[model samples]
Target: MSKLDWHADRGTHPDLALLDLAPESVDIDLAAVRLYRLGRVRAEMNKRDIGAVILSDPINIRYATGTRNMQVFSMRNAPARYLLLTADKSILFEFTGCLHLAEGYETVDEVRPSSTASFVAAGADIEAREKAWAADIGNLIAALVGKGARVGLERLNAGSAIALKAEGFEIVDAQEPVEMARSIKSDEEIKCVIASLRATEAAVADMRAAIRPGITENELWSVLHQSVIARNGDYCETRLLNSGPRSNPWFQESSSHVIGENCLILLDTDVVGCHGYYSDFSRTFHSGPDKPTDDQRTLYKTALEQLHHNMDILKPGLTFREYSDKAWNIPEIYEPNRYYLSAHGCGMTGEYPYLYHHRDFADAGYDGVVEPGMTLCVESYIGATGGREGVKLEQQLLITETGTELLSLFPFEEDLM
Candidate 1:
């Protein structure tokens, strides 16, 4: 397989010496890209008749405002940050200590300090503090949205929802609008994703080189983590680094379990790389000094086949339902632990257009058309019913006018194949 050519000479940064030239001389302007994203979101909102949207999800906030501060903390604690987007204004409700960070960002129309009371503070009435927080948010909503006016809300806490309802505002699910807007990426967004994939693939190379017998799973996992951070990337979203027996059933996080000789090592890099774009892909490796057993080889071959089969069928204008109907049928032996979908859309993180298998579509999938400019991660996990281990493989791709373009370039283990 041909690898992706990363153009290091055409860097993301503009040449400083060309500052005297006209603004149009710059090839790419990230600030303009962010504005384009915000505009797309607003257009989606307008199409849905959503007068305003309250965003608490960090990714959503970043998409709307292009500000990254305390993202990890904000994900766990809802009160840490939020963004309120109205037709006429955009406001950021920031945590007490982080308000200063929001300043000078062009996307933010206003930055207001969020509530200070901790949700789990000792000796404090948690319920009362929650009510107070809700009241504050309600007041803000009341000011923007008239009484009984409909507003969009994305992942609001129960307390806040109740408060908004009591304040006479109609709440609507706003996540779909944002998700739709994010489903198809812009050129700049694709650039960021490519940058992230480059860093992640490099890290995976480091991990492959460092893998050896007797190394604990946690130690091996840290190799990828360290490589990513050392290159200015962000954190890995999940701890899906496992080996040996843990690789059979899948979904196992890294642990202290030592990798024995000739064990199967399964790894998924869910790293949020440069500029917070996510690079998600999985690979299976064989621990050295012995070759993979026949069973292991069979599992690996089957998984790789499934991954490629799914990838080969992807094309522009293919609907989710159509793709599901035509997707590769899993053999009976490997059906027990089959993943929910053959592929999922990826940008900042796994987002929309989740392409499910035929059997699972009715229960968990939605219908949508695959269009140009969308990125998807094809996935596969193959292990027999009574097998000792499984193989997990994934690839990231970009949908084009004619077919698909591979974004991930990590090679499969040729020995196992």
Candidate 2:
């Protein structure tokens, strides 16, 4: 048989198995490219007199240094330092508590013996890890900085970056340039997010089809998870497969709730697709044989219709609130006594720049207009907060030239009841 040809009858392919895990090599070049771009940013900051820029933010650290340490991982503490535009170039530190952990490696090949995965079959080797940790970040930053440069602190944070900054380093914040660099999604980021949405959709669909009256919420999560794995996706984010009424919005899972009759299974499995990317969605499945009662039918159809309306209007230049409020026809919303808005953007952390006001964005500063790269989840739900029944139609979409393009499942049915 040809190397390219596979036995259709074979249960699984060896090559496919070998290619399983998502690329482990951190996107270091991506970080470096952003670093080079930071020089111009530093020039801009210099004009602003933001002296001794220090990057306390995790995103900023990753942006300046090609390694994956500090920042969010060490929320209470950041590892090393990266100083751009300083005559010293960049300076990384070996902090006190940071002695034990090895920041991610150069290649997966080196990752085997002491890596997160390998150490798991056996426990991680603290000694080897510390050595690697000490070696990698220092060398990498030195290379980026080009040795013996008069580097000063470029930034610092109150919580994590504090410990590192105390070590005889100057401190500053490149907040503007670093954030500007991180703000826009690159072509590659968009593709990964797009694949993410697809994986999420598949998982949800699988769970929907497999959802049964006797199955617990957790069981449903397992079924969907299996499907995601089959597609080379993962359900690592959000405590998935765990759901209950008292639970927060993003929690979706199974329980002993005994999918009995008359109960509408409310689900907010917002992050059930990929470890790298996530898509937020909600669906209230009718566990038992459900008849579309008059009220249920009206609300479901209205919610679905409202989602479509906003989807039609979701292109560039439309303010965030505009897309949100338009989803619920004000006149109709008032008529039905519905209070919730339609939906918002779905990406990292399940929902960043949360759409539809829910206390925090009361002023809705997210007047940030839709751009082509933005991926939004259009979901409108009402009826659960003491009102009768509820409806939430969720579909992931991206803004496009002519109109918005739907990346999520289509032909959105009104009654998943």
Candidate 3:
């Protein structure tokens, strides 16, 4: 009989983090991510020949206006924080109650907090918050007029749109300001992502340790949930504890199938650390004292080799198609007809930037260049149908000028049975 072998693999590469992330919401330098955002906003304004930008997307709010509040969770919260940009200077106008930007003068020029929701509900003098909203954007327009540049809007959410319409201010749709900029990560962002990967790896190790025959998939999932929180991984988008037959289908789980001898435990995983930065990693384990079948060993080793081989090819300036096609080929050589997802973005969301599957005779939407500072979760899977089980090899990677680096280390054994 052979024992299951599990090991830790790198999740995010070192030298990937571009900023100093400490203590979560406080004392962290978001300058890198912020500057990148601002630069993109300005670029959009310049392209549209506009002078100012308005932001409404909550996700991009902190990047442009430096306003990170729980208010983002509430759609009722209007865009009181209107950032006015000029050639010589930029000013931000926000509701005053936000503590994070209470006195960040250089970053946020002016703030006006308002609690007009309950007032509006009562239909009383609810004009205070509304006036603040109108005034903030109105003031931004006035500031831009001072610069003599045609005011342009970099981005805005639907709430901001209503306010702009009420103010009779014409807003230019310039979504290009920050979407692509976020595609490329910064050193600080990479660092936070790496930390997230470390925490995820620890949690996965605990989950793997807890796996045994007779355990329910739900039970194993609970172990993973507890393990991740036990570490620094306080929150996660998905706590996948797929095992047994569920391991074959991608993203399969939420089942009650009990683990028996020779069962396969598939852990498709991720964890959030700083802000929304995340780490995604995957590993597979077999629950059994018996030796792995010839097919299991063959597929597992092939996936592992493909992981390392693809890692060697990680670098900057390559098109997404190049990596997808190149990386996919390695797994194809190993597993023949197995499923292979070369890489995907591992940031604020999982399944980001979409998967790298065959499209139009080649990879699609991957034409974007892989530049330095972009972090990706590259994975390869080998599985059979009808609960035949499978194995997945996944690692978090960051693109650097020199090459690629791994964030967390997962088990690297050729066989796990």
For model 3, give the 10-residue run with minimal summed lDDT: 1-10
Q: For candidate 1, lDDT tens digit of each residue in 325-413?
A: 98889999889889767899998889987889999999998898999989999999987777778899999999988999999999999
lDDT of 2 by residue, 1-417 (tens): 632243223422343223222442123233224445445445555565543454444445444443333333433433333333342344434234542232331111111111121232224563454344434433443465433322233333232234223332333455555544444344555565666666767777887787666777667767766776676654445434433242223233456555555445555555534324456665656554665466656656666666677677777777776655554453433334343445665544334344663332456446666776666777665443345456555767776655676776534445542
Better of 1 and 3 by TM-score: 1
Q: What stretches of model 2 exceed 4 Å from their correct place? A: 1-160, 164-183, 239-254, 272-275, 321-342, 357-366, 414-417
TM-score for each prediction? 0.90, 0.60, 0.70
Question: Stretches of candidate 1 above 4 Å error?
Answer: 1-28, 116-118, 121-135
Which lDDT tens digits does candidate 3 get at residues 100-138?
Answer: 343432345545443332343325545554455556656
Which stretches of model 3 miss by more than 4 angstroms? 1-59, 62-175, 230-234, 330-341, 350-355, 358-363, 385-387
Candidate 2 lDDT (Cα, 0 to 1): 0.48
What's the count of clashing pairs in each model shown? 0, 19, 34
**By descending lDDT, how would the candidates be arranged?**
1, 3, 2
- Candidate order by TM-score, decreasing, is 1, 3, 2
Question: TM-score for model 2?
Answer: 0.60
lDDT of 1 at 181: 87
